[model samples]
Target: MTPIESQWIERLKQLPPKRVAEVLDFVAFLAAREERAAAPQRLSDGLARLVALALPAITEDEVEDEIQAARRERRASQQEA
Candidate 1:
Protein backbone atom coordinates (compact mmCIF):
# COMPACT_ATOMS: atom_id res chain seq x y z
CA MET A 1 0.00 0.00 0.00
CA THR A 2 0.99 3.68 0.13
CA PRO A 3 3.48 4.95 2.68
CA ILE A 4 0.80 6.74 4.70
CA GLU A 5 -1.33 3.58 4.83
CA SER A 6 1.72 1.54 5.86
CA GLN A 7 2.55 4.06 8.55
CA TRP A 8 -0.99 4.01 9.85
CA ILE A 9 -1.02 0.22 10.00
CA GLU A 10 2.26 0.17 11.82
CA ARG A 11 1.01 2.69 14.35
CA LEU A 12 -2.20 0.75 14.85
CA LYS A 13 -0.20 -2.42 15.35
CA GLN A 14 1.64 -0.77 18.24
CA LEU A 15 -1.64 -0.23 20.08
CA PRO A 16 -3.40 -2.74 22.32
CA PRO A 17 -6.54 -4.51 21.11
CA LYS A 18 -8.87 -2.18 22.96
CA ARG A 19 -7.11 0.93 21.70
CA VAL A 20 -7.23 -0.46 18.16
CA ALA A 21 -10.97 -0.98 18.51
CA GLU A 22 -11.37 2.58 19.76
CA VAL A 23 -9.42 3.90 16.78
CA LEU A 24 -11.62 1.91 14.41
CA ASP A 25 -14.73 3.24 16.12
CA PHE A 26 -13.46 6.80 15.88
CA VAL A 27 -12.72 6.35 12.16
CA ALA A 28 -16.22 5.07 11.57
CA PHE A 29 -17.65 8.04 13.47
CA LEU A 30 -15.67 10.48 11.30
CA ALA A 31 -16.96 8.78 8.11
CA ALA A 32 -20.54 8.89 9.40
CA ARG A 33 -20.17 12.57 10.34
CA GLU A 34 -18.96 13.37 6.81
CA GLU A 35 -21.91 11.53 5.27
CA ARG A 36 -24.38 13.37 7.50
CA ALA A 37 -22.86 16.74 6.56
CA ALA A 38 -23.25 16.06 2.83
CA ALA A 39 -26.81 14.70 3.10
CA PRO A 40 -28.42 18.15 3.56
CA GLN A 41 -26.60 19.59 0.53
CA ARG A 42 -27.76 16.62 -1.53
CA LEU A 43 -31.37 17.16 -0.42
CA SER A 44 -31.17 20.90 -1.15
CA ASP A 45 -29.72 20.22 -4.63
CA GLY A 46 -32.58 17.85 -5.44
CA LEU A 47 -35.15 20.39 -4.23
CA ALA A 48 -33.56 23.16 -6.34
CA ARG A 49 -33.66 20.92 -9.42
CA LEU A 50 -37.36 20.13 -8.81
CA VAL A 51 -38.19 23.82 -8.35
CA ALA A 52 -36.32 24.72 -11.53
CA LEU A 53 -38.28 22.13 -13.51
CA ALA A 54 -41.69 23.10 -12.03
CA LEU A 55 -41.29 26.90 -12.08
CA PRO A 56 -38.53 27.77 -14.54
CA ALA A 57 -39.59 31.39 -14.97
CA ILE A 58 -41.11 32.12 -11.54
CA THR A 59 -39.62 35.11 -9.71
CA GLU A 60 -39.16 35.64 -5.97
CA ASP A 61 -41.59 38.62 -5.95
CA GLU A 62 -44.25 36.52 -7.67
CA VAL A 63 -43.78 33.75 -5.08
CA GLU A 64 -44.12 36.23 -2.21
CA ASP A 65 -47.33 37.69 -3.71
CA GLU A 66 -48.80 34.21 -4.15
CA ILE A 67 -48.01 33.37 -0.52
CA GLN A 68 -49.64 36.57 0.75
CA ALA A 69 -52.78 35.97 -1.37
CA ALA A 70 -53.11 32.39 -0.11
CA ARG A 71 -52.75 33.53 3.50
CA ARG A 72 -55.44 36.18 3.01
CA GLU A 73 -57.82 33.69 1.39
CA ARG A 74 -57.28 31.20 4.22
CA ARG A 75 -57.90 33.88 6.87
CA ALA A 76 -61.07 35.06 5.09
CA SER A 77 -62.42 31.49 4.95
CA GLN A 78 -61.58 30.99 8.63
CA GLN A 79 -63.46 34.17 9.58
CA GLU A 80 -66.51 33.01 7.58
CA ALA A 81 -66.51 29.64 9.34
Candidate 2:
Protein backbone atom coordinates (compact mmCIF):
# COMPACT_ATOMS: atom_id res chain seq x y z
CA MET A 1 0.00 0.00 0.00
CA THR A 2 0.92 3.69 -0.12
CA PRO A 3 2.96 5.28 2.67
CA ILE A 4 0.02 7.24 4.11
CA GLU A 5 -2.28 4.24 4.15
CA SER A 6 0.41 2.13 5.80
CA GLN A 7 1.09 4.77 8.43
CA TRP A 8 -2.61 5.20 9.19
CA ILE A 9 -3.06 1.45 9.66
CA GLU A 10 -0.07 1.26 12.02
CA ARG A 11 -1.36 4.17 14.08
CA LEU A 12 -4.87 2.74 14.27
CA LYS A 13 -3.53 -0.63 15.43
CA GLN A 14 -1.85 1.04 18.42
CA LEU A 15 -5.05 2.78 19.57
CA PRO A 16 -7.50 1.11 21.95
CA PRO A 17 -10.79 -0.19 20.60
CA LYS A 18 -12.80 2.71 22.01
CA ARG A 19 -10.46 5.30 20.54
CA VAL A 20 -10.59 3.58 17.19
CA ALA A 21 -14.37 3.63 17.28
CA GLU A 22 -14.33 7.33 18.16
CA VAL A 23 -12.02 8.08 15.22
CA LEU A 24 -14.29 6.15 12.87
CA ASP A 25 -17.35 7.94 14.16
CA PHE A 26 -15.64 11.32 13.78
CA VAL A 27 -14.64 10.55 10.19
CA ALA A 28 -18.20 9.54 9.40
CA PHE A 29 -19.51 12.77 10.93
CA LEU A 30 -17.12 14.84 8.84
CA ALA A 31 -18.23 13.06 5.66
CA ALA A 32 -21.91 13.57 6.50
CA ARG A 33 -21.38 17.28 7.28
CA GLU A 34 -19.69 17.73 3.91
CA GLU A 35 -22.62 16.00 2.14
CA ARG A 36 -25.15 18.20 3.94
CA ALA A 37 -23.32 21.38 2.92
CA ALA A 38 -23.16 20.30 -0.73
CA ALA A 39 -26.86 19.33 -0.77
CA PRO A 40 -27.98 22.99 -0.68
CA GLN A 41 -25.83 24.01 -3.66
CA ARG A 42 -27.20 21.07 -5.64
CA LEU A 43 -30.77 22.06 -4.81
CA SER A 44 -30.16 25.72 -5.58
CA ASP A 45 -28.59 24.88 -8.92
CA GLY A 46 -31.66 22.88 -9.95
CA LEU A 47 -33.99 25.64 -8.81
CA ALA A 48 -32.01 28.26 -10.72
CA ARG A 49 -32.44 26.29 -13.93
CA LEU A 50 -36.17 26.02 -13.34
CA VAL A 51 -36.45 29.72 -12.54
CA ALA A 52 -34.63 30.63 -15.73
CA LEU A 53 -37.12 28.63 -17.79
CA ALA A 54 -40.20 29.84 -15.89
CA LEU A 55 -39.30 33.48 -15.29
CA PRO A 56 -41.13 34.72 -18.39
CA ALA A 57 -44.37 33.03 -17.33
CA ILE A 58 -44.51 34.56 -13.84
CA THR A 59 -45.07 38.27 -13.09
CA GLU A 60 -43.12 40.31 -10.56
CA ASP A 61 -46.33 41.14 -8.68
CA GLU A 62 -47.11 37.45 -8.20
CA VAL A 63 -43.62 36.90 -6.85
CA GLU A 64 -43.98 39.79 -4.41
CA ASP A 65 -47.36 38.57 -3.22
CA GLU A 66 -45.98 35.08 -2.61
CA ILE A 67 -43.04 36.57 -0.70
CA GLN A 68 -45.39 38.59 1.50
CA ALA A 69 -47.56 35.56 2.22
CA ALA A 70 -44.54 33.48 3.13
CA ARG A 71 -43.24 36.16 5.47
CA ARG A 72 -46.62 36.47 7.19
CA GLU A 73 -46.81 32.70 7.68
CA ARG A 74 -43.29 32.61 9.07
CA ARG A 75 -44.05 35.42 11.52
CA ALA A 76 -47.25 33.71 12.66
CA SER A 77 -45.40 30.44 13.25
CA GLN A 78 -42.64 32.20 15.20
CA GLN A 79 -45.23 33.93 17.37
CA GLU A 80 -46.85 30.59 18.09
CA ALA A 81 -43.52 29.16 19.16
Please tell me which predicted candidate would have the highest lDDT against the true structure. 1
Query: Which consecutive 10 residues in model 1 have the weakest lDDT in total?
Result: 49-58
Best of the candidates, TM-score:
1
lDDT of 1: 0.97
In terms of lDDT, the poorest run of 10 residues in model 2 is 50-59
Per candidate, the number of residue pairs that clash is 0, 0
- Angstrom error at residue 49, model 1: 2.3
RMSD of 1: 9.0
lDDT tens digits, residues 1-81, model 2? 999999999999999999999999999999999999999999999999998887567689999999999999999999999
lDDT of 1 by residue, 10-79 (tens): 9999999999999999999999999999999999999999988886687999999999999999999999
Question: How does each model score on lDDT?
Answer: 0.97, 0.96
TM-score of each: 0.60, 0.56
